[model samples]
Target: MPQEKPDLRNLAEPVRFKRALTLLLMTLVLPGSAQIAAGSKRAGRWAWRVIFGIVAIIVFLVLLSLVWRSGTINLLVSPKTLRLVQILLILLAIGWAALFVDAYRLGRPLTLERNHRLTASIVDGVLVVLVMSVLIYGSTIVSAQRDFVASVFGNGQKSKADKGRYNVLLLGGDSGADRIGTRPDSITMASVDAETGRTVLIGLPRNMAKIPFPAGTEMAKQFPHGFEWKNCGHDCYLNGVYTWAMGHKQFFPGVKEPGLLATSQAVEGITGMKVNYYVLIDIAGFQHLLDAVGGITVDVGKKVPIGGIGGPIKGYIQPGRNQHLDGYHAMWFARSRAGASDYERMTRQKCVMTAMLNQLSPQKVLTKFQAIASASKEVVQTNIPAGELGTFTDLALDSKKLPVSSFSPVPPLIHTGDPDFALVRTKVAEAISKSEALDKAASDGNGKKSNTPSKAPTKPATSGKPTGSPSKPSTDVDDVASICKA
Candidate 1:
């Protein structure tokens, strides 16, 4: 018998169109292609499927526009509706998990079973609509809430800046109800390079000393009466810790709030950068804020399948790689010290942030939109100015192609000292040298790196304790001390 001719509909497209369509799916994964990939057995399977797929995708786009706003604002979803949606998402996730495994193992266009036109047409069509809706709506909620939550939690008091690179001192504190001692968790100097639109984060281990800030004479100037700002027995350096350059007297009649000037001044002097802003959040505040923003998105990676205690995750977000983290999990990820040390914990914190950024991608945010917006309630705090926020949005969106850079604690050159203030001074001096170099390069317009990139970064002479968030803040000289002592 002669070979049978292929159906016109099932026949593949011309070389160029096929190649273009395939390329588009590789990155875009449009709903139509997804539905077409479902089943087979039709006479004009390819043509008919693609046609229907386009129509379905249009539906997906329209649905996305309708629910986009719901993701950003704190919409009141009826509990019943919310539960139903959650259940549907769960079911979709299961289906996605199956498809995901197959796609990974077999690769695309690799057939899994005999094509079934009728079944594939119906199921694929429904699934495409359902999945697309979740993706678009979910992500929109998460991203919008992530940025705005900072303003809400800070109580209308966020960081401020102008057209140039803006700097902020990010501080983490260990204050908690169960804490043995209250101290800074970690300090990082962070800066946003407006020109390059890149973010730079630096970690300052609290253990390092000889920092600068509490000007040696600050004691005499601000707290001539003592460190007690509102009360005679209050912590002397407490107030100064939150606002850069503020002065205070010694507390405990003689005991100091560590060294006041050494750490702060050293940081300012070394980085050659100004101490424009600072803020301190207690452990409770950090944890509470995270809970408020519905929690951040975290990706589970081979890096950490088994947690600090070798605990099994009952669907603890699978270990391979994923995003969307809640406060509870993120807290442990950043704070877990079981098998990891303070340094390792900082790295984990950075990972959490990176995962958040990945999930915030335009395509992903649309799915988790509602949860993201609701969570933004108490999770973040910053000092970036309102005017700069619009600019920042543009910069962040463009950051995809921008080269991201980060540095580690400098070594041997700096160390913690007996008098806390003395060690702070040393750190400040080291940072100043760096800041000055960058400033000069920026002035000359010969620098490809940001105006705030660390001039130099090396492991500290010794392993020290972490005192702030994993990474440093933008434009902060006192970050090292802030993270360590917060």
Candidate 2:
């Protein structure tokens, strides 16, 4: 009875095997527990400190995000913070894997049966691989985000919100080997309320003539009258403003993007809204962006050509209801103008924009973040500062919940060939005023009966319609969702 005690290292095969598994399981759950229980207490204590420290930091960040969202986002987006996190993840992966190995040694695998030893080895190897793989993958994502933020933003000057709104000029730059340089094919100004996130999209036809430059600006001193090329005739239009400025870069001394600056000035002079920033999207890279989000769905009212502006028509995205389109077809849907008028094309472009805004959910973004980041780097060019990304991102998420109103000066409303600048400015002001009124009403809980149309105007005619033929163009739409709906 006095010799009943059994040695832990000399237990039966089944007992030894069970003990080995228990140690491995403990290491998996808490890296240093096995070490403290059976091995070096010093190493186990250090590992425990690191694990606790990491948990503390994570819990602090989570709490911070709940109370101060933008602050947390800024911390995450900071390049310095990202580098620190990446290094920490790598070290943590290595240290955690080492702890698992140490735990395996503490299990005394060699003392077990052959089958037991093999089983323990396999389980330890799997746990190490799984843990390391997750940490490494997270590090890669953080690295990609850091590179994306660095490359895409911070080139442009920072701007403050003018009054209660932020006006951003969105340009769709079209360039090819056939063309000499990039031209902004699509021009839209997204004016967002700084507080409520209420948004109004103001569109300018690419062919709009007589675009004026803001007073006291360099563009104003050069083009005092309006944007016009004498011999170019009708060829000189809003889109050509970029090409013209690029040719006259000397006028904008020390400016990085003279073309963009000049174009922004022109937009300011036309819309009478101060431009806070500009985002230029290369049309060629747009398809990649659409594909990254697994494509978008849109109601195609008329056929859209694949490639027919300068070349033969490759194909047509046939008209249908709730058509799910891949990157290629969606790009064509947004850019095609083969038989469609510019106004028709603009409507479709807005539809595509609305579809993207409504369809790109946060879940999709998290799952396809790598692909989206890669595509965005290639597709987007902006002057928006890296510091303001958190605010804008938060605003963007807020905007998704509200209706997006749109205004486009088209035929009957205004002549692109002989645009009335005074009338254009008036309409722009009216649209913004209406959006603000609706936002106020909604906030006051009295917006349900508001007269603003809830649906977007019907799609413009694409085929068998002459450029001058008047289509039913609503001067403004209160909700773009109706326009984009199937």
Candidate whose lDDT is highest = 2
Q: Which stretches of candidate 1 lie over 4 Å from their true place?
A: 1-163, 180-183, 214-270, 276-327, 366-370, 410-413, 418-486
Q: In terms of TM-score, which candidate is strongest? A: 2
lDDT of 1 by residue, 148-207 (tens): 544443323444443355555656655545543445565655555555455555555554
* Residue-by-residue lDDT tens digits, candidate 2, 1-486: 477535666678898888888888998899899989888989999989999998999999999988877678888898899999999999989998998898888778889889999999999999999999999999998899899899898744668899789999999999999986899999999999886676888878999987888899987887788887763355579998888889888988898789899899999999989999999999888999999999887777766788987799999987767688889988888888898788877777777776777678888888898899999999999989888887788777777766778899877989988889898999999988888776666553543333222332333222111111112344675455545443
Relative to the true structure, candidate 2 has a C-alpha RMSD (angstroms) of 5.1
> Where does the lowest 10-residue lDDT sum fall in candidate 1?
458-467
Location of the lowest summed lDDT over 10 successive residues in candidate 2:
461-470
User: What RMSD does each model have against the real structure?
Assistant: 14.6, 5.1
Off by over 4 Å in 2: 1-6, 231-234, 444-473
What TM-score do all the candidates reach, one by one? 0.43, 0.91
